[model samples]
Target: MRWSETCLSEQLGIDPGKELQQLYLRILRQDPALTLDPPVLATEPAAVKHNLPAQVTSFNGRDWEMIEVREMITEHRLVTLVGGGGVGKSRLAVEVAQNVLDDFPDGVWLVELPPLVQPGITAQSLAKALSLGEHPIVPLEEVIEDRLKRKKRS
Candidate 1:
C-alpha cells in the first residue's frame, strides 16, 4: 500500500510541511516493507563501549531527580528533559543515558542536534552520527532504521 505525507502526519498527530511529507513518501516508496513497529532481534552481549563524555566535576544533590530519571529511562524507550538553557538538562540526559547503557546492547548514542538548522536534517544528522553513509536512492531515515534493525539482530 502507498502512503502520503498528509495521511501519515495526521495519523502521527504532527504537522509536517510539504518537503517533509515528500521525504516521508520517498522513504516509504524506497522501502515497501517498512512498518510502524520496529523489528525485535534476539538480545546479545554489547560489543562496544558507550560514547558518554567524562564528568568534569562532581554531581551534587538532585539525587531524587536522578533516581526518578533513571527509572523513567528504564521504563520508557524515549525520554525528554525540558528546561531552559544552562539548566543542566543535557547533563541530566547524558547521565541518565549513561546509567542505562547496559540496558541497550547496541550501545547508547548521543546525537547532538544543536548544530541542525532545519528539522528536515534530523535523519541526516542521525545518519552521520551513526557513521552511515548517504545513499542516492534511499532516504536517510530508511538507512538509519535499517542500520538500527541490523544492530538489534547482531
Candidate 2:
C-alpha cells in the first residue's frame, strides 16, 4: 500500500474522511439557535479511539525532537515534556501522539492542563479529558488507570 494510505488506514485505523463527514452532517442537522450539545461520541472500545482535536497550524521542522520523543514514548509508558511558555511543547507533543497512535490500540489520549484549572482538580481534569464522566462510586485515579491498562503494550 502507498505510504499516505498506510498511515491513515493502518496507523489510525479509520476511514479518514468518514469521521469528518459524520461531524459535518451532524453539525448541519443541529438547530442554529440552540446551544450545541457536548460531543456525543462513540464510547465503545471497538470504535476508532482518539479524541485528538484537529490541528489549526502546520508543524514545520523539528525532526530530531520528534524522533527522540517518539522513541521515549515507545520505550516508557509515560513521557513528559518540559519547556518554557511558547516553546511549541504542546504542538510537538500532539504531533508525536498523532504519529504513535497505531502503537496504542485503545487510544492515545491527550490531557490538557490549562492555567485556569485549580491545583486540586488535576485528576478530575484528566478523567474529564478522557470522557470518563463523574464516577461517584469509584476513585477517578483508579478509573483512569483501568482505562490506560486496557491496551496491551506491543
Candidate 3:
C-alpha cells in the first residue's frame, strides 16, 4: 500500500471504507475469481526520519513557484533555492518537501545549515542531520553514499 494511503487511514484516522468499497465493487464486477481481504494497517518504520519543524503560519501565494521547485527536485538529484532573508525560501522548501514526502521511499530530511559558522563542517552537519555517528574505518561521505544507495534500491 502507498504510504499516503496508509497515513490517511492510520495517522489522520480518515476511514478509507468508501474508497475501498468502490475499488472492491469494481474489481468484483470485472472478475469473480479474485478475492479481496481487508487491508491491515501497519506503520512501516522509515529508513530515514527527520524532525521537520511545523508550519505555524498559513502559506499564501507562490503556487507556481512551489510546483516548479517540486518538479525540479523530482527530475534532478540536487536543487538549490536561493532568496534573501524572510522571503519564504525555507518555508517554500519545507512545503515542497512535505508535498513530495510520499515520493521518497526512505524518507525526506531537512538539514538546517544556518547555525554552522564554517564551511568545513558542512559534512558533519549533514551527518548530524542524518543521525549518523562517526565510523572508525569508513569515511562519512562514503557511509552516507552507501546508505543512500541502499535506500534508492529499496
Backbone N/Cα/C clashes per model: 0, 0, 0
lDDT of 3 at 103: 81
Error of 3 at 103 (Å): 1.1
lDDT of 2 by residue, 40-132 (tens): 767745775677878988899999999999999888765768788899888998999998888887778777666645764767777786788
Runs in model 2 with CA error above 4 Å?
A: 1-46
Measured with C-alpha atoms, the lDDT of residue 16 in candidate 1 is 64
- lDDT, candidates in the order shown: 0.71, 0.76, 0.73
Poorest stretch of ten by lDDT in candidate 2: 15-24
> Candidate 1, residue 101: CA error in Å?
1.7
lDDT of 3 by residue, 1-154 (tens): 3565687789998866777767756775876557678788697654545456888888889999999998897775446677677888889889988877778766777766664587647667667877888799998887766665565311
- In candidate 1, list every pair of residues with a backbone clash: none
True-vs-predicted CA distance for residue 68, candidate 2, Å: 2.3
Give me the overall lDDT of model 2.
0.76
**Ten contiguous residues minimizing lDDT sum, candidate 1:** 1-10
Superposed model 1: Cα runs more than 4 Å off: 1-47, 63-72, 75-82, 149-154
Q: Best candidate, lDDT-wise?
A: 2
Model 1, span 12-125: residue lDDT tens: 866667777676677868765554677677797646655678788767778888999888866654455776778987787777777777677777776655644778677766
